[model samples]
Target: MKNDLERAFEEARRRDAIELEWLGASIQGRPTFAEAELLDRRGIPSCHVWKIPRNEAPVHLTAIDALRRWQAGACAMCSASPRRLLVDHCHRTGLVRGLLCTSCNTAEGLQSAPSFVAYRERPPAVILGVEEMYGSPWGEEIAPSDASPEERTQRNAAHVDAAEGLFAGITDRFRPECADG
Candidate 1:
Protein backbone atom coordinates (compact mmCIF):
# COMPACT_ATOMS: atom_id res chain seq x y z
CA MET A 1 0.00 0.00 0.00
CA LYS A 2 2.80 2.47 0.93
CA ASN A 3 4.74 1.67 -2.27
CA ASP A 4 1.60 2.18 -4.42
CA LEU A 5 0.87 5.58 -2.76
CA GLU A 6 4.49 6.72 -3.27
CA ARG A 7 4.40 5.76 -6.97
CA ALA A 8 1.12 7.65 -7.51
CA PHE A 9 2.53 10.79 -5.82
CA GLU A 10 5.63 10.65 -8.02
CA GLU A 11 3.48 10.24 -11.13
CA ALA A 12 1.30 13.22 -10.20
CA ARG A 13 4.39 15.40 -9.60
CA ARG A 14 5.85 14.39 -12.95
CA ARG A 15 2.58 15.34 -14.75
CA ASP A 16 2.45 18.72 -13.02
CA ALA A 17 6.10 19.41 -13.93
CA ILE A 18 5.43 18.60 -17.60
CA GLU A 19 2.32 20.79 -17.70
CA LEU A 20 4.23 23.69 -16.12
CA GLU A 21 6.98 23.32 -18.69
CA TRP A 22 4.45 23.41 -21.51
CA LEU A 23 2.78 26.51 -20.03
CA GLY A 24 6.15 28.24 -19.72
CA ALA A 25 6.94 27.50 -23.34
CA SER A 26 3.54 28.74 -24.40
CA ILE A 27 4.05 32.02 -22.54
CA GLN A 28 7.47 32.38 -24.13
CA GLY A 29 5.79 32.32 -27.59
CA ARG A 30 6.78 28.79 -28.55
CA PRO A 31 4.33 26.82 -30.74
CA THR A 32 2.78 23.61 -29.40
CA PHE A 33 2.73 20.33 -31.41
CA ALA A 34 -0.81 21.04 -32.68
CA GLU A 35 0.06 24.66 -33.53
CA ALA A 36 3.13 23.47 -35.47
CA GLU A 37 0.90 21.15 -37.50
CA LEU A 38 -1.45 24.03 -38.32
CA LEU A 39 1.52 26.25 -39.22
CA ASP A 40 2.76 23.65 -41.75
CA ARG A 41 -0.66 22.87 -43.27
CA ARG A 42 -2.46 26.23 -43.21
CA GLY A 43 0.53 28.59 -42.92
CA ILE A 44 -1.31 30.29 -40.09
CA PRO A 45 0.41 33.36 -38.62
CA SER A 46 2.26 32.76 -35.36
CA CYS A 47 0.56 35.70 -33.64
CA HIS A 48 -2.91 34.29 -34.34
CA VAL A 49 -2.24 30.68 -33.21
CA TRP A 50 -2.93 29.24 -29.76
CA LYS A 51 -3.12 25.81 -28.13
CA ILE A 52 -5.83 24.30 -25.92
CA PRO A 53 -5.39 21.20 -23.78
CA ARG A 54 -7.33 18.21 -25.10
CA ASN A 55 -7.04 14.40 -25.45
CA GLU A 56 -6.12 15.00 -29.09
CA ALA A 57 -3.77 17.95 -29.61
CA PRO A 58 -5.96 20.91 -30.59
CA VAL A 59 -5.22 24.39 -31.91
CA HIS A 60 -7.55 27.32 -32.53
CA LEU A 61 -7.89 28.66 -36.07
CA THR A 62 -5.89 31.62 -37.34
CA ALA A 63 -7.27 35.16 -37.72
CA ILE A 64 -7.22 34.79 -41.50
CA ASP A 65 -9.22 31.58 -41.22
CA ALA A 66 -11.78 33.34 -38.99
CA LEU A 67 -12.00 36.26 -41.44
CA ARG A 68 -12.51 33.85 -44.36
CA ARG A 69 -15.12 31.83 -42.46
CA TRP A 70 -17.14 34.73 -41.08
CA GLN A 71 -16.63 36.92 -44.19
CA ALA A 72 -17.82 40.19 -42.66
CA GLY A 73 -16.33 43.23 -40.96
CA ALA A 74 -18.72 42.82 -38.03
CA CYS A 75 -18.88 40.81 -34.82
CA ALA A 76 -20.77 37.46 -34.64
CA MET A 77 -22.68 38.98 -31.72
CA CYS A 78 -24.24 42.50 -31.52
CA SER A 79 -23.64 43.17 -35.27
CA ALA A 80 -20.99 45.73 -34.34
CA SER A 81 -17.84 46.53 -36.35
CA PRO A 82 -14.89 44.11 -36.00
CA ARG A 83 -12.37 46.82 -35.03
CA ARG A 84 -11.95 45.25 -31.58
CA LEU A 85 -13.32 41.79 -32.19
CA LEU A 86 -12.01 39.13 -29.78
CA VAL A 87 -11.66 35.39 -30.19
CA ASP A 88 -14.39 33.78 -28.11
CA HIS A 89 -14.36 30.20 -26.86
CA CYS A 90 -15.98 27.86 -24.37
CA HIS A 91 -14.24 28.47 -21.03
CA ARG A 92 -14.92 24.91 -19.79
CA THR A 93 -14.11 23.05 -23.01
CA GLY A 94 -11.67 25.47 -24.73
CA LEU A 95 -13.60 24.97 -27.97
CA VAL A 96 -13.54 27.96 -30.31
CA ARG A 97 -16.97 29.55 -30.80
CA GLY A 98 -16.43 32.69 -32.91
CA LEU A 99 -15.33 36.32 -32.86
CA LEU A 100 -17.24 38.81 -30.71
CA CYS A 101 -17.00 42.52 -30.03
CA THR A 102 -15.58 43.55 -26.67
CA SER A 103 -18.96 44.36 -25.11
CA CYS A 104 -20.57 41.06 -26.18
CA ASN A 105 -17.54 39.05 -25.09
CA THR A 106 -17.51 40.62 -21.63
CA ALA A 107 -21.31 40.15 -21.28
CA GLU A 108 -21.15 36.48 -22.37
CA GLY A 109 -18.24 35.72 -20.02
CA LEU A 110 -19.97 37.40 -17.07
CA GLN A 111 -23.27 35.60 -17.77
CA SER A 112 -21.55 32.18 -17.80
CA ALA A 113 -19.46 32.59 -14.62
CA PRO A 114 -20.86 30.97 -11.44
CA SER A 115 -20.24 34.02 -9.24
CA PHE A 116 -22.23 36.29 -11.55
CA VAL A 117 -25.18 33.86 -11.52
CA ALA A 118 -25.03 33.61 -7.74
CA TYR A 119 -24.94 37.39 -7.41
CA ARG A 120 -28.03 37.71 -9.61
CA GLU A 121 -29.86 35.10 -7.48
CA ARG A 122 -29.56 37.30 -4.38
CA PRO A 123 -32.05 40.15 -3.93
CA PRO A 124 -30.77 43.67 -4.60
CA ALA A 125 -30.05 45.83 -1.52
CA VAL A 126 -31.30 48.97 -3.29
CA ILE A 127 -33.25 49.81 -6.40
CA LEU A 128 -33.53 53.17 -8.18
CA GLY A 129 -36.67 54.54 -9.84
CA VAL A 130 -36.72 54.51 -13.68
CA GLU A 131 -37.42 58.26 -13.70
CA GLU A 132 -34.11 58.92 -11.90
CA MET A 133 -32.07 57.53 -14.78
CA TYR A 134 -34.38 57.72 -17.85
CA GLY A 135 -35.20 61.49 -17.45
CA SER A 136 -38.00 61.50 -20.07
CA PRO A 137 -36.06 61.70 -23.38
CA TRP A 138 -39.32 61.20 -25.33
CA GLY A 139 -41.18 63.99 -23.47
CA GLU A 140 -40.53 66.56 -26.21
CA GLU A 141 -40.82 64.24 -29.27
CA ILE A 142 -44.02 62.43 -28.20
CA ALA A 143 -46.78 62.79 -25.63
CA PRO A 144 -49.35 60.10 -24.69
CA SER A 145 -52.17 62.66 -24.07
CA ASP A 146 -51.58 64.35 -27.49
CA ALA A 147 -52.18 61.14 -29.48
CA SER A 148 -55.53 59.27 -29.51
CA PRO A 149 -55.66 55.43 -29.50
CA GLU A 150 -56.07 55.19 -33.30
CA GLU A 151 -53.21 57.66 -33.93
CA ARG A 152 -50.97 55.75 -31.50
CA THR A 153 -51.74 52.49 -33.32
CA GLN A 154 -50.88 54.11 -36.67
CA ARG A 155 -47.59 55.47 -35.33
CA ASN A 156 -46.66 52.01 -33.98
CA ALA A 157 -47.49 50.38 -37.31
CA ALA A 158 -45.33 52.89 -39.19
CA HIS A 159 -42.37 52.22 -36.85
CA VAL A 160 -42.75 48.45 -37.32
CA ASP A 161 -42.86 48.86 -41.13
CA ALA A 162 -39.67 50.96 -41.11
CA ALA A 163 -37.89 48.35 -38.99
CA GLU A 164 -38.96 45.53 -41.32
CA GLY A 165 -37.75 47.48 -44.34
CA LEU A 166 -34.36 48.07 -42.73
CA PHE A 167 -33.93 44.37 -41.93
CA ALA A 168 -35.02 43.38 -45.45
CA GLY A 169 -32.31 45.55 -47.00
CA ILE A 170 -29.51 43.81 -45.01
CA THR A 171 -28.11 40.77 -46.87
CA ASP A 172 -27.85 37.36 -45.19
CA ARG A 173 -24.52 36.04 -46.51
CA PHE A 174 -24.73 32.81 -44.47
CA ARG A 175 -27.68 31.50 -46.54
CA PRO A 176 -26.79 31.45 -50.22
CA GLU A 177 -30.40 30.72 -51.21
CA CYS A 178 -31.60 33.80 -49.29
CA ALA A 179 -28.93 36.13 -50.71
CA ASP A 180 -30.31 39.40 -52.10
CA GLY A 181 -30.82 39.53 -55.85
Candidate 2:
Protein backbone atom coordinates (compact mmCIF):
# COMPACT_ATOMS: atom_id res chain seq x y z
CA MET A 1 0.00 0.00 0.00
CA LYS A 2 3.06 2.27 0.31
CA ASN A 3 3.62 4.85 -2.40
CA ASP A 4 6.89 4.93 -4.37
CA LEU A 5 8.08 7.97 -2.46
CA GLU A 6 7.35 6.28 0.86
CA ARG A 7 9.30 3.17 -0.22
CA ALA A 8 12.24 5.30 -1.31
CA PHE A 9 12.31 7.07 2.05
CA GLU A 10 12.23 3.76 3.85
CA GLU A 11 15.13 2.44 1.77
CA ALA A 12 17.14 5.60 2.40
CA ARG A 13 16.59 5.31 6.12
CA ARG A 14 17.65 1.68 6.06
CA ARG A 15 20.83 2.53 4.19
CA ASP A 16 21.63 5.39 6.59
CA ALA A 17 21.26 3.07 9.53
CA ILE A 18 23.61 0.57 7.94
CA GLU A 19 26.17 3.25 7.18
CA LEU A 20 26.09 4.56 10.74
CA GLU A 21 26.53 1.09 12.16
CA TRP A 22 29.43 0.43 9.83
CA LEU A 23 31.16 3.66 10.79
CA GLY A 24 30.77 2.98 14.48
CA ALA A 25 32.09 -0.54 14.14
CA SER A 26 35.05 0.58 12.04
CA ILE A 27 36.13 3.20 14.58
CA GLN A 28 35.71 0.79 17.46
CA GLY A 29 37.59 -2.03 15.77
CA ARG A 30 40.58 -0.04 14.51
CA PRO A 31 43.61 -0.03 16.79
CA THR A 32 46.01 2.82 17.32
CA PHE A 33 49.64 2.38 16.27
CA ALA A 34 50.75 1.87 19.83
CA GLU A 35 48.08 -0.75 20.39
CA ALA A 36 49.16 -2.59 17.26
CA GLU A 37 52.80 -2.51 18.37
CA LEU A 38 51.91 -3.82 21.78
CA LEU A 39 49.89 -6.63 20.24
CA ASP A 40 52.79 -7.43 17.95
CA ARG A 41 55.25 -7.53 20.85
CA ARG A 42 52.98 -9.91 22.71
CA GLY A 43 53.46 -12.50 19.94
CA ILE A 44 49.93 -12.11 18.78
CA PRO A 45 48.88 -11.93 15.16
CA SER A 46 46.90 -8.71 14.81
CA CYS A 47 45.15 -9.72 11.61
CA HIS A 48 41.88 -10.66 13.23
CA VAL A 49 41.69 -7.44 15.21
CA TRP A 50 39.93 -5.73 12.36
CA LYS A 51 36.82 -7.72 13.17
CA ILE A 52 34.20 -7.15 15.81
CA PRO A 53 31.79 -9.75 17.13
CA ARG A 54 30.49 -11.41 13.97
CA ASN A 55 26.83 -11.04 14.91
CA GLU A 56 27.29 -7.31 15.42
CA ALA A 57 29.39 -6.56 12.35
CA PRO A 58 28.08 -5.45 8.98
CA VAL A 59 28.38 -7.79 6.01
CA HIS A 60 31.09 -5.67 4.36
CA LEU A 61 33.20 -5.63 7.52
CA THR A 62 32.84 -9.36 7.88
CA ALA A 63 33.81 -9.80 4.23
CA ILE A 64 36.92 -7.69 4.78
CA ASP A 65 37.80 -9.71 7.84
CA ALA A 66 37.45 -12.88 5.85
CA LEU A 67 39.65 -11.49 3.10
CA ARG A 68 42.32 -10.39 5.57
CA ARG A 69 42.35 -13.83 7.14
CA TRP A 70 42.63 -15.42 3.71
CA GLN A 71 45.71 -13.29 3.06
CA ALA A 72 47.21 -14.60 6.33
CA GLY A 73 47.89 -11.16 7.78
CA ALA A 74 50.67 -10.59 5.25
CA CYS A 75 51.01 -7.98 2.57
CA ALA A 76 49.41 -9.37 -0.56
CA MET A 77 52.48 -8.45 -2.64
CA CYS A 78 55.54 -8.94 -0.38
CA SER A 79 54.00 -11.19 2.28
CA ALA A 80 55.31 -8.97 5.04
CA SER A 81 53.22 -9.01 8.19
CA PRO A 82 53.48 -5.34 8.96
CA ARG A 83 51.83 -4.04 12.13
CA ARG A 84 49.43 -2.07 9.98
CA LEU A 85 48.18 -2.88 6.50
CA LEU A 86 46.53 -0.40 4.21
CA VAL A 87 43.40 -1.29 2.30
CA ASP A 88 44.24 -0.85 -1.35
CA HIS A 89 41.32 0.13 -3.56
CA CYS A 90 40.80 1.05 -7.17
CA HIS A 91 40.73 4.84 -7.47
CA ARG A 92 38.63 4.83 -10.60
CA THR A 93 35.92 2.47 -9.40
CA GLY A 94 36.24 2.76 -5.60
CA LEU A 95 36.47 -1.01 -5.20
CA VAL A 96 38.90 -2.43 -2.65
CA ARG A 97 41.81 -4.24 -4.29
CA GLY A 98 43.52 -5.86 -1.32
CA LEU A 99 45.61 -5.17 1.73
CA LEU A 100 49.16 -3.91 1.15
CA CYS A 101 52.18 -2.80 3.07
CA THR A 102 53.17 0.84 2.90
CA SER A 103 55.95 0.26 0.41
CA CYS A 104 53.85 -1.79 -1.97
CA ASN A 105 51.00 0.66 -1.67
CA THR A 106 53.33 3.49 -2.60
CA ALA A 107 54.89 1.51 -5.45
CA GLU A 108 51.43 0.69 -6.81
CA GLY A 109 50.69 4.38 -7.26
CA LEU A 110 53.31 4.67 -9.96
CA GLN A 111 51.90 4.02 -13.44
CA SER A 112 55.07 2.38 -14.76
CA ALA A 113 55.72 0.18 -11.73
CA PRO A 114 55.39 -3.55 -12.04
CA SER A 115 52.91 -3.52 -9.19
CA PHE A 116 50.68 -1.20 -11.15
CA VAL A 117 50.91 -3.39 -14.23
CA ALA A 118 50.14 -6.45 -12.21
CA TYR A 119 47.19 -4.75 -10.61
CA ARG A 120 45.87 -3.69 -13.97
CA GLU A 121 46.25 -7.17 -15.36
CA ARG A 122 44.65 -8.93 -12.45
CA PRO A 123 42.87 -6.80 -9.92
CA PRO A 124 42.67 -8.66 -6.63
CA ALA A 125 39.23 -7.32 -5.92
CA VAL A 126 37.83 -8.75 -9.09
CA ILE A 127 39.72 -12.04 -8.78
CA LEU A 128 38.86 -12.77 -5.16
CA GLY A 129 35.12 -11.91 -5.45
CA VAL A 130 35.59 -8.92 -3.16
CA GLU A 131 34.14 -6.68 -5.83
CA GLU A 132 31.08 -8.85 -6.04
CA MET A 133 30.52 -8.55 -2.32
CA TYR A 134 31.09 -4.80 -2.44
CA GLY A 135 29.15 -4.48 -5.70
CA SER A 136 30.97 -3.52 -8.88
CA PRO A 137 31.18 0.15 -9.80
CA TRP A 138 31.24 -0.73 -13.48
CA GLY A 139 30.59 -3.87 -15.45
CA GLU A 140 33.49 -6.22 -16.22
CA GLU A 141 33.13 -5.42 -19.88
CA ILE A 142 35.24 -2.28 -19.35
CA ALA A 143 37.96 -3.91 -17.30
CA PRO A 144 41.46 -2.46 -17.25
CA SER A 145 42.98 -5.21 -19.38
CA ASP A 146 40.46 -4.55 -22.12
CA ALA A 147 40.78 -0.78 -22.00
CA SER A 148 42.61 1.30 -24.60
CA PRO A 149 46.01 2.76 -23.75
CA GLU A 150 44.47 6.20 -23.25
CA GLU A 151 41.90 4.75 -20.89
CA ARG A 152 44.62 2.95 -18.98
CA THR A 153 46.60 6.15 -18.68
CA GLN A 154 43.58 8.01 -17.41
CA ARG A 155 42.87 5.30 -14.89
CA ASN A 156 46.47 5.35 -13.70
CA ALA A 157 46.38 9.11 -13.34
CA ALA A 158 43.17 8.86 -11.35
CA HIS A 159 44.81 6.32 -9.08
CA VAL A 160 47.72 8.64 -8.37
CA ASP A 161 45.40 11.51 -7.72
CA ALA A 162 43.28 9.44 -5.36
CA ALA A 163 46.33 8.19 -3.49
CA GLU A 164 47.67 11.69 -3.10
CA GLY A 165 44.29 12.87 -1.87
CA LEU A 166 44.21 10.11 0.72
CA PHE A 167 47.73 10.88 1.92
CA ALA A 168 47.01 14.58 2.10
CA GLY A 169 44.01 13.91 4.35
CA ILE A 170 46.08 12.16 6.99
CA THR A 171 46.20 14.29 10.11
CA ASP A 172 48.99 14.80 12.64
CA ARG A 173 47.33 12.25 14.91
CA PHE A 174 48.41 9.48 12.54
CA ARG A 175 51.85 10.92 11.78
CA PRO A 176 54.90 9.07 13.07
CA GLU A 177 55.82 11.78 15.57
CA CYS A 178 52.40 11.64 17.18
CA ALA A 179 52.14 7.85 16.96
CA ASP A 180 55.47 7.41 18.70
CA GLY A 181 54.22 9.41 21.64
Candidate 3:
Protein backbone atom coordinates (compact mmCIF):
# COMPACT_ATOMS: atom_id res chain seq x y z
CA MET A 1 0.00 0.00 0.00
CA LYS A 2 1.23 3.47 -0.78
CA ASN A 3 2.01 5.69 2.16
CA ASP A 4 0.36 9.08 2.58
CA LEU A 5 3.43 10.85 1.30
CA GLU A 6 3.68 8.65 -1.74
CA ARG A 7 0.03 9.08 -2.52
CA ALA A 8 0.34 12.83 -2.11
CA PHE A 9 3.32 12.90 -4.45
CA GLU A 10 1.46 10.96 -7.10
CA GLU A 11 -1.54 13.19 -6.84
CA ALA A 12 0.62 16.30 -6.99
CA ARG A 13 2.31 15.15 -10.17
CA ARG A 14 -1.04 14.55 -11.77
CA ARG A 15 -2.37 17.91 -10.70
CA ASP A 16 0.78 19.70 -11.77
CA ALA A 17 0.52 18.37 -15.30
CA ILE A 18 -3.11 19.38 -15.49
CA GLU A 19 -2.35 22.89 -14.29
CA LEU A 20 0.46 23.31 -16.80
CA GLU A 21 -1.76 22.24 -19.64
CA TRP A 22 -4.48 24.59 -18.57
CA LEU A 23 -2.03 27.47 -18.25
CA GLY A 24 -0.57 26.83 -21.65
CA ALA A 25 -3.99 26.91 -23.25
CA SER A 26 -5.12 29.92 -21.29
CA ILE A 27 -2.03 31.97 -22.08
CA GLN A 28 -2.21 31.13 -25.77
CA GLY A 29 -5.51 32.93 -25.92
CA ARG A 30 -4.38 36.06 -24.09
CA PRO A 31 -1.67 38.68 -24.44
CA THR A 32 -0.22 37.91 -21.04
CA PHE A 33 3.46 38.06 -21.86
CA ALA A 34 3.66 41.71 -20.82
CA GLU A 35 1.70 41.01 -17.67
CA ALA A 36 3.92 38.04 -16.88
CA GLU A 37 7.01 40.15 -17.35
CA LEU A 38 5.63 42.81 -15.01
CA LEU A 39 4.85 40.31 -12.31
CA ASP A 40 8.23 38.66 -12.71
CA ARG A 41 9.87 42.04 -12.29
CA ARG A 42 8.02 42.43 -9.00
CA GLY A 43 9.12 38.96 -7.83
CA ILE A 44 5.62 37.64 -8.13
CA PRO A 45 5.24 34.50 -10.18
CA SER A 46 2.79 35.10 -13.01
CA CYS A 47 2.55 31.37 -13.46
CA HIS A 48 3.98 28.39 -11.60
CA VAL A 49 6.32 25.98 -13.31
CA TRP A 50 8.14 22.99 -11.88
CA LYS A 51 11.82 23.31 -12.55
CA ILE A 52 14.60 20.82 -11.76
CA PRO A 53 17.30 22.31 -9.56
CA ARG A 54 20.94 21.93 -10.53
CA ASN A 55 22.69 19.12 -8.61
CA GLU A 56 19.70 18.53 -6.41
CA ALA A 57 16.60 16.40 -6.16
CA PRO A 58 13.64 18.22 -7.68
CA VAL A 59 10.89 19.44 -5.38
CA HIS A 60 7.86 17.72 -6.76
CA LEU A 61 4.40 19.24 -6.81
CA THR A 62 3.55 16.81 -4.07
CA ALA A 63 5.57 18.85 -1.61
CA ILE A 64 3.33 21.86 -2.10
CA ASP A 65 0.20 19.73 -1.88
CA ALA A 66 1.50 17.97 1.19
CA LEU A 67 2.28 21.34 2.73
CA ARG A 68 -1.24 22.53 2.02
CA ARG A 69 -2.59 19.51 3.83
CA TRP A 70 -0.13 20.02 6.64
CA GLN A 71 -1.26 23.59 7.03
CA ALA A 72 -4.85 22.37 7.15
CA GLY A 73 -5.70 24.34 3.98
CA ALA A 74 -5.23 27.67 5.69
CA CYS A 75 -3.14 30.72 4.84
CA ALA A 76 0.19 30.23 6.56
CA MET A 77 0.45 33.92 7.32
CA CYS A 78 -3.00 34.80 8.65
CA SER A 79 -4.33 31.34 9.53
CA ALA A 80 -7.46 31.89 7.51
CA SER A 81 -8.94 28.59 6.37
CA PRO A 82 -9.69 29.37 2.78
CA ARG A 83 -11.29 26.91 0.43
CA ARG A 84 -8.32 27.01 -1.91
CA LEU A 85 -4.76 27.89 -1.01
CA LEU A 86 -2.20 29.20 -3.47
CA VAL A 87 1.29 27.76 -3.42
CA ASP A 88 3.76 30.40 -2.28
CA HIS A 89 7.25 29.81 -3.66
CA CYS A 90 10.49 31.65 -3.97
CA HIS A 91 10.48 33.39 -7.35
CA ARG A 92 14.25 33.03 -7.58
CA THR A 93 14.71 29.38 -6.68
CA GLY A 94 11.27 28.04 -7.48
CA LEU A 95 11.35 26.48 -4.05
CA VAL A 96 8.10 25.65 -2.32
CA ARG A 97 7.82 28.14 0.55
CA GLY A 98 4.31 27.54 1.90
CA LEU A 99 0.64 27.78 1.13
CA LEU A 100 -1.37 30.95 1.57
CA CYS A 101 -4.91 31.99 0.97
CA THR A 102 -5.54 34.40 -1.91
CA SER A 103 -5.55 37.54 0.22
CA CYS A 104 -2.24 36.89 1.96
CA ASN A 105 -0.56 35.77 -1.24
CA THR A 106 -1.62 38.93 -3.06
CA ALA A 107 -0.58 41.16 -0.17
CA GLU A 108 2.79 39.49 0.14
CA GLY A 109 3.53 39.89 -3.55
CA LEU A 110 2.66 43.56 -3.42
CA GLN A 111 4.43 44.44 -0.19
CA SER A 112 7.25 41.93 0.37
CA ALA A 113 6.72 42.66 4.03
CA PRO A 114 8.83 41.36 6.89
CA SER A 115 6.27 38.73 7.85
CA PHE A 116 6.46 37.17 4.39
CA VAL A 117 10.24 37.32 4.45
CA ALA A 118 10.32 35.56 7.81
CA TYR A 119 7.82 32.98 6.62
CA ARG A 120 9.91 32.12 3.58
CA GLU A 121 13.18 32.03 5.47
CA ARG A 122 11.97 29.28 7.75
CA PRO A 123 8.95 27.73 6.18
CA PRO A 124 7.01 25.30 8.32
CA ALA A 125 7.83 22.48 5.91
CA VAL A 126 11.51 22.90 6.63
CA ILE A 127 10.98 23.41 10.37
CA LEU A 128 8.73 20.36 10.89
CA GLY A 129 10.75 18.03 8.63
CA VAL A 130 8.07 17.78 5.98
CA GLU A 131 10.67 18.64 3.34
CA GLU A 132 13.06 15.96 4.57
CA MET A 133 10.46 13.30 3.94
CA TYR A 134 10.51 14.40 0.30
CA GLY A 135 14.33 14.25 -0.01
CA SER A 136 15.01 17.81 1.10
CA PRO A 137 14.21 19.23 -2.29
CA TRP A 138 15.19 22.67 -1.07
CA GLY A 139 18.80 21.42 -1.13
CA GLU A 140 19.89 22.43 2.38
CA GLU A 141 17.28 23.56 4.83
CA ILE A 142 18.47 26.88 6.28
CA ALA A 143 16.49 27.37 9.39
CA PRO A 144 15.68 31.08 9.75
CA SER A 145 16.92 31.01 13.32
CA ASP A 146 20.28 29.71 12.17
CA ALA A 147 20.91 32.12 9.29
CA SER A 148 22.90 35.24 10.03
CA PRO A 149 21.39 38.64 9.20
CA GLU A 150 23.82 39.06 6.31
CA GLU A 151 22.91 35.72 4.83
CA ARG A 152 19.22 36.59 4.91
CA THR A 153 19.84 39.94 3.23
CA GLN A 154 21.94 38.33 0.52
CA ARG A 155 19.34 35.65 -0.08
CA ASN A 156 16.60 38.24 -0.46
CA ALA A 157 18.71 40.20 -2.94
CA ALA A 158 19.32 37.07 -4.99
CA HIS A 159 15.60 36.49 -5.20
CA VAL A 160 15.13 40.00 -6.61
CA ASP A 161 17.84 39.48 -9.22
CA ALA A 162 16.46 36.14 -10.30
CA ALA A 163 12.95 37.48 -10.63
CA GLU A 164 14.23 40.10 -13.08
CA GLY A 165 15.67 37.32 -15.22
CA LEU A 166 12.73 34.93 -15.01
CA PHE A 167 10.98 36.01 -18.20
CA ALA A 168 14.04 36.94 -20.18
CA GLY A 169 14.07 33.82 -22.30
CA ILE A 170 10.44 34.10 -23.35
CA THR A 171 10.55 37.65 -24.65
CA ASP A 172 11.32 36.58 -28.21
CA ARG A 173 8.26 34.36 -28.41
CA PHE A 174 5.73 37.14 -28.04
CA ARG A 175 4.34 38.68 -31.21
CA PRO A 176 5.11 42.33 -31.75
CA GLU A 177 2.33 44.81 -32.22
CA CYS A 178 1.31 45.26 -35.84
CA ALA A 179 1.34 48.63 -37.57
CA ASP A 180 -1.19 49.67 -40.17
CA GLY A 181 0.20 49.53 -43.70
The estimated TM-scores of all candidates read: 0.26, 0.40, 0.39
- Full-model lDDT for every candidate: 0.41, 0.56, 0.52
Which residue pairs show backbone clashes in model 1? none
* Local accuracy of candidate 1 as per-residue lDDT tens digits, 28-80: 44454455445534533222333322221112323334332332344443345
Candidate 1, overall lDDT?
A: 0.41
Question: Top lDDT: which candidate number?
Answer: 2
Q: Which 10-residue window in model 3 sums to the lowest lDDT?
A: 49-58
Clashing pairs in 3: none
Which clashing pairs does model 2 show? none
Clash count per candidate? 0, 0, 0
Segments in model 2 whose C-alpha atoms lie over 4 Å from true places = 1-62, 132-181
Over the full model, what C-alpha lDDT does candidate 2 score relative to the true structure?
0.56
Q: Candidate 3: list runs displaced more than 4 Å.
A: 1-61, 131-181
What digit string (tens of lDDT, one per residue) describes model 2 on residues 99-171? Answer: 7789768877774644456555555444444452232234332225556667856766765676578777576
- Give per-model CA RMSD: 21.1, 12.1, 14.9
Of the two candidates 2 and 3, the one with more favorable TM-score, higher being better, is: 2
Output the worst ten-in-a-row residue range by lDDT, candidate 2.
132-141
Ranking by lDDT: 2, 3, 1
